[model samples]
Target: MLYKVLEVPGIEYIVLDFKSSDGNFIAQDLDDSETWNAKAFYQWLIDEVLVFTDDGISGMDKDLYKQFKAFANQRGVCVCDSRKI
Candidate 1:
């Protein structure tokens, strides 16, 4: 399973060089965030993206996922755990 943390403006997320677990991380130019504008990214996250893993490990940890999903749901953030990837 691939796990990641996404930080908003005031928070700090995990950093990566190419691939990443941090939200808003750049795959190319580390500072070239303008290309990966957050609004569009978040929109895609809510509408299209999901916490999926190629090994079909997404949302496998049910208790934790459910707690986080509940938290996100309360805050109106999108957190999907409908099935395995």
Candidate 2:
């Protein structure tokens, strides 16, 4: 059997290690929960994910930076500045 994968055009796949204070290496996400609306960010992801469903955002593994890259690529489809930010 052959397995096929899809990705957004011109979307560069990125893989890199990032760190968070208080030692998230054991558990927890890289996002800064302090002084940031985790709920809003989560909701933003949900909202954007729905819009980018036709692109290449669905079924992508939500592990570490992989999901964000896909999300970024999907977001890249609609918004330019947010991808940079």
lDDT of each: 0.40, 0.33
Cα shift from native, residue 56, model 2 (Å): 11
Model 2 per-residue lDDT tens digits across residues 1-85: 0011123222223222225463222212235322323233334444533223444344543352355544445434322223334
lDDT of 2: 0.33
Colliding residue pairs in candidate 2: none
Clashes of each: 0, 0
- Write candidate 1's Cα lDDT for 1-85 as tens digits: 1133242122233233434454333322235443333333433444454455543225345554455455445545565433432
Candidate 1 — what's its lDDT? 0.40
Mark the regions of model 2 whose C-alpha exceeds 4 Å error after superposition: 1-36, 50-59, 62-85
* Candidate 2 residue 67 C-alpha distance from true site, Å: 11
